[model samples]
Target chain A: MSVIKTFGKYRNLLGELVKKDIKLKYRNSYLGVIWTMLEPLLTMLVLTLVFSELLGKGTKDFPVYILTGRLLFSFYSNGTKAALKAVRNNAGMIKKVYVPKYMYPLASVLSGYVIFLISLVVLAVVAVVRGVYPTLQLFWIVVPLAQILLLTLGSGMLLSTMAVFFRDIEYLWGVALMLLMYTCAIFYKIDSVITGTNGWIFKYNPLYAIIVNFRNAVFGQAPDFQSMFYATAFGAVLMLFGTFVFYKQQDKFILYL
Target chain B: MSEMSAVTVQDLGVKFHLSEQKVDNLKEYVIRILKHQMRYKEFWALREVSFDIKKGERVAILGLNGAGKSTLLKVIAGVLKATEGKVTRSGVLVPLLELGAGFDQQYTGAENIYLYGAMLGYPKAFLREKFDEIVAFSELGEFIDVPVKNYSSGMRARLGFSIATLVEPEILILDEVLSVGDVKFRKKSENRIKEMFRQETTVLFVSHNLAQVRSLCTRALWLEKGRLVEDGPVEVVTEHFEKATTK
Candidate 1:
């Protein structure tokens, strides 16, 4: 089935799952929606402290750098991790109900977007406090960043589905992301890694471009257009191919699960 | 049986993969994969299970516990895939396979109308119109806004059954879920089932209650150890099921 049509088919179920995921995040917490801010806020503070005070890096507006890293990481980690279990976690629903199975993964991706909205508010406030002016160019950051989401979600669907068959992938993904943190220039300066051997790794890694794009757009700098182009094109293909794999393998999911 | 076949299954089968020990983490999974130590065991939850039912053909699947009756219905409902053979369902096959499997415990009963309504194949708009009706049926008036996990078993059953039976599926599959509710709620559920049955939905009902089976089903398929032991008029098949279990 075409990706567009399949999504078009499970639209209602997709929306419902997104609602459920969002509700679940704040469900039992006494502070409710406040916890959403607290995660990135606390993480940002700790990361700023380490990189500025401990590492002695040339840290100007440490909160800005920390928040930037956190926002992207939140979107990627939270999105990918949630989507990775989309099929296996909903086994009962999959076994009992006949939804377009790919809806489960897509919902996970969409749920991440919903949380990103929360993180966006927090990031904007931090940026304003740190004296970062809004660039009209920064608004354009949304385009490439959205592509990054597509790439992660599309690939995450395939990965999560396959993870059921090969259980080691989920664990492997965690370590891989840790490696990615260094390459994406999440904590450190992007220019420092833009040379020679480090340059080769950053140029090739899809997330490197995504982090650069976010820094440029949200933090008011220019992103590497070549990396963004590669990320966008690759993301489109992955969404198509990923949904296709999910469609083909969805029938066997209940049995395997 | 009515003239229109709403549910059909031919030579349907199921299999499972079994491992030597419990698989807890990545290390165990890697070892299992590397050693080729995972055993593929065909449990045959349903072996060559074939049946057909026209619209409004109330049928009961009678069997001992673990006789693969629920699996058969699930296959027909498009929930479980047949390892072999095919199942052609003419219309919406809502398998209330187990009570409240679709509801998220964290969501409110009101929220679950949309959630479970989606599961039963009804759109949000359609459920919205009948939201009040479902709530009234659940008898969870004040608690509709509260989390479902906090609800009593009976409350959960009411909520589950109400959402399940809200929309009429062309093929409805029930698997011993209604029996768990309180007597009053079960009576309510039975009435709702009877209403949908009267309206000519092909019903694949699975339960251990012989009287309910005889009263509700025009046909009966008796399954034993994943094999069909009898398929005929309810009187004959059910009598065989009773005798086999008693013996």
Candidate 2:
């Protein structure tokens, strides 16, 4: 109960931090927020050309598929990356002020989530261009959206805490994320590449589960309840575990910093 | 824990593990643990320290370098946790440990007011009401819109001081922040702190300036290498501290 009360008290600080992040992200850019909508659109175009034309793979709506997987993966990657550095980057403020330490990682993840949401507009446009329109299933997108957010928050908290103690985690995570991207099947269909029992390799990955469920919502298919349940449970458990570890180690952070 | 006490610190101790050789990365740390080479020397920054401050009293912490004065303030301000024992604070306490530490270099002075104010736990509506007052007090004038990276260190400190002092906290913790900006602004800040003193706010101040401590504090707590050596009236403690240090 007191935890909730503390969060309520610092809600405004969280808002300001999110705003500062988004503002600084586009500070000196000529096009500013226009880049948010443009970057994903261009990336979708490139991926679509590579997968559909040169490689002779994917359906006609492969562009939408790539955008869906790309955007979600980007958010997880970017959010966790920022959160990994959040505590160390704010060592000055941490030493001087008495804010709840979790606020730093929470703010970093939230700021990236905000930008990710804005970029979703690109997905919508590309989906329409490829003859895939919004359906009643679109509302079900919220499930996967929330799942990804929780998963990112969980990983972010855990990574940020580890990062304070071990600087090598930053470099290690970079290589890990690259490996994670390939496993997520961002460009290829999971069924086509991994057959038989090996399919569990992709199915077991929480991010892959989320991407599949999100694509279902985008393509007017019914939500995948099985994958949805698995991903949501995985995200929730990680989040709980992350919060536990973060709080346990937070008091010791000052000594390391 | 008395009704008259604004702050109570009981048997507070803070211990730090000093690694003989820095093992900052995970690989080195893992190898050291695996090889049974993990060695740690415990260093107590503050130990067996206890004190209570009555409401509205001004207390100065007097100590030499490495005497744990700053660590004591950090523990009291809740920035650092006590390794043993606890601190109980009854009112809204603000620690001005390092001004402008929260300011982002990319943000303008005006933007930083809201950012830093929010960081200090001020509500947005409250910051809006006091925005102009803060700008005027900072004397940044038109430079309020200029990015902090462009401001001189003095200007940044001036803006930080203005925002931090805007609200009269129930307990204000100051660590040598009175001497900010130029001579004129320093005097202005001192006067402003005096104004807060008139409101009967509790203050815990740490400074090397004995004369200033004598003027601002009614009582003093002198520390030596993490142990409290003297606690008495400001003048008496300062005299004793000076004589001992000069020997």
Candidate 3:
């Protein structure tokens, strides 16, 4: 009940912060928010050219497969990165104000999530061009979307807290994200390359699990409920743990800052 | 915890770790922990200081530099946590620690009013209703449409002061904010604060100017090196502070 009350009190502040982030993201750019749509489409085209045409890999409608993975991974990457810098970037305000410290990371991740949602229009356009039509299964996309959002928020909170104490976390996370991107199977088929025991690399990663479920929904196939349940549980547990750690260490943040 | 008290602080203490070599990286921290080489010099900014302010009391915190006056105000305003003891506040408290600290340079002065207001926990509708008043008080006029990055420091400070003083909070925390803008604007801002005093709002102020403190506050709390030296009527405490400083 107290949590709900706090949320109600800060809802307007959160909205303003998210709006500021989105507006500043493309402020000086020539095409502005148009980049949101064009970025994904251009990435899909480039990846298809390299993987399908040059490398002679992938099956039918490979562009659709790549688009789904790229969009989800980009959201996760961008959301967590924004969250990582949220606290330090707003150090001036943190030192002067009495706002809940968690609001910074929460707002940053949420702003990135909004931009990610907008970019999905490009995914839909590419899917139609690749002869993949939306069906009733698309309704299930909300499950994977929620799962990824929770995971990003959880990771963002944890990273933001750690980044305050250790500035190296910014550099470390950049390298770790590259490793995670490879493990997510964004442009590769797990069955074609790695078979048998080696498959656990992708299996154990919650982000990969979410991307698979998301692909299942977009490709008009029933999502794997068991995998969805596991991914959701993983995200929920991480989120709870992240929140606990963030709350405990938040008081010390001012001293460090 | 009196019913009439606006703020109650009990045995308040704040300790800061002054590390000889700042270990800001995870690897160094881990290595130090493993080698049992972790060392920190604990410096107490405030120790065993306690006070109570009743509603409508205007108290000036008088202290020399490095006297923990700002730390005490931060604790009362709920911006910093006390290392020991507790502070309880019963009303809406607004701390004007540094005005315009939350402004986004990329945004226009008009956009920043809402942003900074939101940061101060004011509702969007309230800002919209009083938008003209804030702009007029800021004297930004046509510059409201211009981005804040282009604003002069005085112009930025004026905008921040205008938005923050819009709502008459129950407890107003001021830290040298009255000295904002030009000489004329400073007088105007001080008058605005005097108006809030008329509303019976509790105020905790920190300033170096003894004349300003005597004119604006009824009581004074003097601190010397993180310890309270005196707490009494403004005239008596200021007199003591003046004598001690000259010696």
**Model 2: per-residue lDDT, tens digit, A16-126?**
999999999998999999998899888888998988899999698999989999999999999999999999999989998988899999999999999999999888888
Name the runs in model 3 displaced over 4 angstroms: none
- Candidate 3 chain A: worst-modelled 10 consecutive residues by lDDT: A1-10
Residue by residue across A1-257, what tens digits does model 1's lDDT show? 48676556567777888988988888778988788888888888888888877888845676887687668776887788788888888887887777777777778988888788777788888888888878877887787668768877887887877877667778888898788777777677767556665667877777666777777787677776887888888888888888788778877776567
- Order candidates by lDDT, high to low: 2, 3, 1
Quality of model 1 by C-alpha lDDT: 0.79
How does each model score on TM-score?
A: 0.90, 0.98, 0.98
Which RMSD does model 3 reach against the true structure?
1.1
The residue-by-residue lDDT of candidate 3 on A1-257, one tens digit each, is 28777677777789999999999989899999999999988998899899999999966789899989999999999999999999989988888887888999999999999999999988888789779999999999999999999999999999999999999999999999999999998898877779677888877899999999999999999988878988999999999999999999999999888
TM for candidate 1 is 0.90
TM-score of chain B of 2: 0.98
lDDT of each: 0.79, 0.93, 0.92
Q: Which model is ahead, 1 or 3, in terms of TM-score?
A: 3
Q: Candidate 2: where are CA atoms >4 Å away?
A: none
What lDDT score is found at residue B54 in candidate 2?
98
